[model samples]
Target: MNVRGVIAGLLFLPITILLSIAVCLARPFSRLAWPSKVMQLWANSVFWMSGIKLQVVGEEHLTAGKPAIYMANHASMIDIPILVAVLPGHVRFLFKHTLMYVPFLGQAMMLLGMIPINRTNRTKSVESLRKAGERIRSGIDVIIFPEGTRTKTGEMLPFKNGGFLMAIQEGFDIVPVTIHNSREVCGRNSIVTRKGVCRVTIHPRYETTGFTVADRRQIMSDVERIIGSAVQLRGRDNAAPVIELGHH
Candidate 1:
């Protein structure tokens, strides 16, 4: 690790803790806004510390004052901050249930209405999705990593069905965001940081209002293509060609 990187991480610790506290305290009244704000702050701090800048495109594609299911490919851990900082609307993220057990921050995330999934159990995963659907129906935008986990080799992974299922069930529009250059900045499974510019391209939102279970597979396929095309258009040399969900 670079000396500067270690120093930056140390500086980030207190800010992260303070924001965590704010989220925990603000939970009682309404969780619809505070979590988003806290996430935005966290993103800003990370961007500043890592010397990473962002360029957001297609802002017009997002609808204001309406809930959406924001889906994106997982490239790096920094992708979270990039999305939170650049995406147009407020978002609540779907995270692993294990995260809710992390000291003070875990408690804060639980209090602030973040959806927690028990990836080990199918029954619990379904229950988590149902609860997420309810939250979207009630007008809170949700961010889900359809790939379910980060790409190990910078290639898109097989997308899980949970996000699209919830979108169809709740009649929410799906905003497909393509993040570029994040993998190079932090890469997958590595902590060595570098300074670089990241870009988030927001494609036209696809509405799920009239979709049904029969259309689920097709919907996921189309989104995969959209994100793949966006990545290629942005000149990512190794961008993966969109593939059928179960093929790879």
Candidate 2:
């Protein structure tokens, strides 16, 4: 077992509890602002504890005080904190409903008013995205993992249509974010995490102003390609990456 990974994993539970409490306390001060600010701290803490370095490109594309749909290719649980750490504005996630049972994490999600998508049910999932779209129009940035679940391999998964449909319905610009090397740091079903750098490439926003439902497939294909552009083609690994990657 990787010693750093084992130790880091052990600390996660306490770290989560402390951060979750902070989120709950911050909620009373300013609904979204305080909570979001605390989450940024939480994300950074996760990075620190895991010894994971972050490199962000196209951060200029993330406008402050703007509401848009941020679509990203998901690979690992680390991707959650990665999005929270890098993306600007008050951002919330379109997450699985099952996360609602993850102890302190679940309560914090509820406090943040994060949208939970019921993946087992098609209509309910659409309804969840609809609710997320409403949140966007009301001036909140939402991050959606179009892949729906973490990929076991380093390859991109087929993009799901729910988030794209919501983007068209809401008429928000889609920021296609590409996350690199997270799977190596923390793979699916793994409890330990290794030290590594996870580079995030935030491409220029894809506007959905004139796009209709019919255009979603093309849009999904395009966004998926953009995100996959920077991903390294290789078999998946569960430990920290050994080879050097990403420019500083």
State every prediction's TM-score relative to the real structure. Answer: 0.85, 0.88
Rate residue 244 of model 2 by lDDT.
26
Regions of candidate 2 where Cα sits further than 4 Å from its true position: 1-4, 233-248
Q: Whole-model Cα lDDT per candidate? A: 0.76, 0.79
lDDT of 2 by residue, 1-248 (tens): 55767776777767777877777776667877887777777776666666777766677788776678998888887888888888877889988899889877777777767889998898899789888988888778999998888887767788888988888877889999988888888987665788877778888989989999999999999898888886873443334333222221
Over 1-248, each residue of candidate 1 has an lDDT whose tens digit, in order, gives 45544555565546667887888777676566777777777777777666666766777887887888899888887777777777755677798788677766576566557789877899999999988878777777788988888888888988888888878877888989998888888867544467766777888989887789889999999999998776645544324332111121
Weakest ten-residue segment in model 1 by summed lDDT: 239-248
Candidate 2 structure lDDT: 0.79
* Candidate that scores best on lDDT: 2
Best by TM-score: 2
Backbone collision count in every prediction?
Answer: 0, 0
Q: What's the TM for model 1? A: 0.85
44 in model 2: Cα distance from truth in Å?
1.1
